[model samples]
Target: MALHWKLVIDTSDAPTLADFWAAALGYEVEDQSTLIDRLLAAGQLDDSVVTEHRGRRTFRGFAAIRHPDDPFDRDTGVGQGRRVLFQDVPEPKTVKNRLHIDVHAGAEGLAALVERLESLGATRIREFDKGPAGHWWVMRDPEGNEFCAAQ
Candidate 1:
């Protein structure tokens, strides 16, 4: 069988990137605090590794989200379906992403989505063209990771 997995994006700020991708793809942010809670109870993660947000204890560096109704274990809240995991990195991003996501818009629409992404701080870098496959626009995230949105 083919291997199935989620693409983990390593970044300096997980929550910020997660929010950007959530709004960019219309995906909901996943809360995996039950796992965090368990770790905390077990003394695995020290208090310094966690932060308080809205009166809730949130781990500082990890956040995730998935499409609504995607399979996720209720006990731990890790996604078992379509997912993107954003994890924290200490150093700044110094180069482009070796692997990037290509968004398929497929002639349905582009202007609105691109405008929204720009408002969310994504930069529209360039447009790509193909004879039969058509076109897409390449963009860089705030951290300089490149992704393309095309139809």
Candidate 2:
């Protein structure tokens, strides 16, 4: 059986990172505030552990984005597939990423996509002109997470 999985990224600001990744990947930001609200009402969760994010009551230090077409729990809004979870971390990024995401934008569309990503707070790190493998741009997200965009 195939095990289910989701990528988890550490960030200083979970919600902001979620927003950035959601737009970058054309995914939808998961809204789990309803569950949090219910837990708060039942006294199972404290208000101190929740905060308003995008005008919704979400658990502090956690946010996620999922592919829009993926199945998600109706009540909790947790995606069943193709999800990325962002969690708050106290320390800033101090070294290069050991793993990174690669976006395939096709040869004709890469330039435009890279420009769009830059406008959304991605930084152009460098470019690799691989002959047969094609070209791709190395970029860092707002929080310094490295990812590649391929043409």
Candidate 3:
């Protein structure tokens, strides 16, 4: 069996990053508020670690988005696979990303998708048309993380 994993990204503001990615990928932001509420009620967790986000309680230091079709814990809303976790970091992104997400927007949708992303705060970096490799546009998320929108 293949090992399961979720890509984790560091961000200065986890919720904002999570929101952007959720819209970008048509994913759902995981909701762990029920668990948080249970833990808080049982005195197993402190309010210090939680914060209000989008009108719900969420972990202050992290947030996540997952493919809507993927399996997830019903009670906690934690994805079982195919997810991206965003964790808070004190330092900002200072260099190019060594690993980046490449969004596959079919040839017909590439332009529109790129424009939608730009409207969501992604900045266009450049575009390339590799004769055999295909066409793509480089972009940076609101927080400066680089990714590609490709055909």
Candidate 4:
């Protein structure tokens, strides 16, 4: 039997978190229209509850993505297996993450990517290199979540 996983995260703003992760991971945002558009057209979904998303009017709510080849709901655009769901919360993040992502980037391109991320509102928390065999960068997302850009 195969297993699927959804990495759920808590955030003050789900859409902003979604955008940051999408750019950080080089993945496109999943279109959530599969279930929404049909419901709207059928008059089953309320207009006030849904709004525009990615150029189309969608339910004002969640977003997600998957590896290009992964299975997804054709109508809703929800990809099975690998996924990260960012849900809204009232409280702000005030502590360290128990788990984080490590981005493996080539040496030549790492610096440029780091700069780009900084420009996009990420902060370089620190740099780490031991002797000559190890190197990587610790960066904080706009919301202060930690991730590594491995070199």
Error of 3 at 100 (Å): 0.1
State TM-scores per candidate: 0.85, 0.96, 0.97, 0.84
After TM-score superposition, the amount by which residue 132's alpha carbon in candidate 3 deviates from its true location, in angstroms, is: 2.9
- Per-residue lDDT of candidate 1, residues 79-150 (tens digit): 788899888888888887899987666344777667777898899999877957787789987777899887
lDDT of 3 by residue, 46-132 (tens): 889999999999999899999999999988889998999999999989999999999889555889989999999999999999978
RMSD (Å) per prediction: 2.2, 1.1, 1.0, 2.2
Candidate 3 stretches greater than 4 Å from native:
none
Reference-based lDDT, each prediction:
0.80, 0.92, 0.94, 0.76
Clashes of each: 2, 0, 0, 2
What's the ranking of the predictions by TM-score, best on top? 3, 2, 1, 4
lDDT of candidate 4 over 4-53, digit per residue (tens): 87888877666777888888777666777768878888999888877675
Q: Relative to the unseen true structure, what is the C-alpha lDDT of residue 130 in candidate 4, on a scale of 0 to 100?
A: 76
Superposed Cα deviation of residue 96, candidate 4 (Å): 1.0
Worst ten-residue run, lDDT, model 2?
A: 102-111
- Model 2: which residue pairs collide? none
CA error at residue 138 for candidate 1, angstroms? 0.7
Off by over 4 Å in 2: 106-108
